[model samples]
Target: MTDSADTLRARLTEAGRVCGGWCTVHIDFSEDRENPEGLAESRRRSVRDRLNRMGADDATVAAIEDALSTPSGLPSPFSRFLLARDGEVAVDEAVPGAARGETLEVGVLPRLAPLIATGVDEFPYLVVRTSRDGGDVAVHRTGAFFPESTASVEGRTDTLHKVKGGGWAQLNQQEHVEELWKQNQQELSAEVDRLVREVRPRLLVVSGDVKARRLLLDAVGQAARSIAVELDANTRSDGTDAARLDAFVAEQVAAVEQRDRADALDLLRSRVSQERAAADVGLREVVGALQQAQVDTLFVDVAALDGETLLALDGVPWVARPGDETGDAEAVGEVPAAEAILRAALLTDARILTATQQATGAGAAALLRWPAASVTGA
Candidate 1:
């Protein structure tokens, strides 16, 4: 009753109708089978199984099955599709990045941003530095949100029995200064012990007259105190006081960064002997690699970045500048791509290295692990 060409056209139209509106998904096999019928059946069953596994509703599964069985000349379920080239598209969509713990440094001057509680309970620790002039003490707490770190401060609680200091100390005689120093030392020692027992600061920085310095050292104890003696022309504390406090905090944080960098470099250098040493280049590539469990270490630069932006890698969205909000749209400045990568490395606990070392071999800022290396030579 009907010609073969006309019948084929009818079949194709019917098939197209049946297949309507379904998305195309590509699945690769080890080998392509020669038998089209077998392949088609297999593909139908596979698609059904996959859809079921994906928690598709019974109605949806039935629709896909019915569409797959159509003989009409639409794109069949058995038709192969191009595979996704990027590994990111292929891998599990949940957790991305290398699975390894890392050290993070959060530098903060309390005047700038007050130290609030951090949500991460696993591998980070806090280090605090308090600097005071005669008027007010600027407490700058530098956080090493990782393991193996300490804090330090300048030495000199030396105070005079002058009008400004309430005339309490006998600074003229060596023995008197020493005796009063000892008594104040004892008192301070008791206070430090109580603070250590109560507040438990990893490090304490007290900068003032000789009495305050010695008193803090006394309060904590010589062993507990990481004291950096202030040696300069004038013993008077001024605005430079905060700078001195930051220096102390930076010094300690630097020590930790150095150790981390050394460890990372050593590990990377060792991998040079291996047959296949992996490396990633550019900021986006490194982060994608890290998420894919390929990256080992990450180096990050902190210059020209706000502290809030630096610390924002912990999951909060960061705004570089102010913006205008209209209805549903909010406009914001483009953040530096490098900063984003660095924050990722920090929050993800990837080993972080700075790029400003003196040695030729020691001047890369990066996060290190096994196999993958940063493209930025940091």
Candidate 2:
């Protein structure tokens, strides 16, 4: 089974109960300059160094070492190494999707809650380029790229001769040629709509014949046009500049990410002003809403995940103040507030959106599935 955010959350919750040590390691496999053997060895050494710095117990360290020594036998572009031991609770698996950069994390529980929240950062997008007669389309997700679908439309090839360059016959033939081009555009537009519905990409990038592109755009629905990013560069079905295409896609992806973040923040601000129950701002309110499975979309500052702590009271997480006396007061120590909230969101199957500090000044906020009662009452 895939190691999704839900599975990771369940594993962490189960592992948290076990009385033992845990180690989490994240390695970037984006470097293609080195050979496979050398890269694996380097990653292993890096994990060992991180473990050594933590001064982990012998059994825990041995388990991690053994797990790392054995290959997964599957092609994994990214790496997330997790190991825990408490009478047989060992989590050793390589996560499939990760962005570029080295992220090494080790803690008593899997320090992967934040990663789950940021999963959307790797969501796929569709790229389509139309040609004179046909077009090529591809899907890009995470670090993987694959062709999704293709389209083709035939147009008039023969040239019509004019009678002394002024004849109704020549004009009629020109209109016929234009009609064929319109038909081609219509066919491509229908295909685009189908692909968008199936893939639900975060962005749609289109580049190719200008007239065809315009006609297709006009034919496509508003939803498709809303997310579409038109490229002015020349492209064809058989030949394409790989480097230039990659750069263009990367730039569009960054722009889409920025827009998404800004939109989430804008919604948060709007909701806060209205004092709407469906939107929550600040840590305490957001945590409470999450615990109730009321959150629809959670917007959290990346820095906030490591800034605050939450106490687990009778296995239920809560954001308690210094002298607050709630429940049995039987504290189960403290866990990262971000992790606790993330765990709750996963359990409820809510969407998680990571925002910048400037966007989420209160550390965390959430859009609820339904209106929640006042936090004071809860």
At residue 172, candidate 1 shows an lDDT of 41
Give per-candidate clash totals.
34, 0
lDDT of 2 by residue, 1-378 (tens): 233333444565555443225565555543344587677678777776777788665566666656666655544455544645532324544555554445554544555453454353356677877754545666666433344344554544454222345578877876776666666667777777887888688888988878768877888888789889888766765555655766788799878877876787787777766744578888888877866667888887756556688754434333344455655535544677876666556556677777765676677889877766654434
Listed per candidate, the RMSD to the true structure in angstroms reads 25.9, 6.0
For each candidate, give its TM-score against the true structure.
Answer: 0.33, 0.69
Please provide the root mean square deviation of candidate 2 (C-alpha atoms, Å).
6.0
Question: What stretches of model 2 exceed 4 Å from their correct place?
Answer: 1-23, 34-36, 48-108, 113-118, 121-124, 140-180, 275-277, 304-307, 312-333, 370-378
Per-residue lDDT tens digits of candidate 1, residues 202-299? 44444455554544454555534653333221223443554565455556645655565577666555654465455443344454554443445654
Model 1 reaches what TM-score against the true structure?
0.33
Off by over 4 Å in 1: 1-138, 142-180, 190-219, 227-285, 293-297, 301-340, 346-378
What's model 1's lDDT at 299? 46
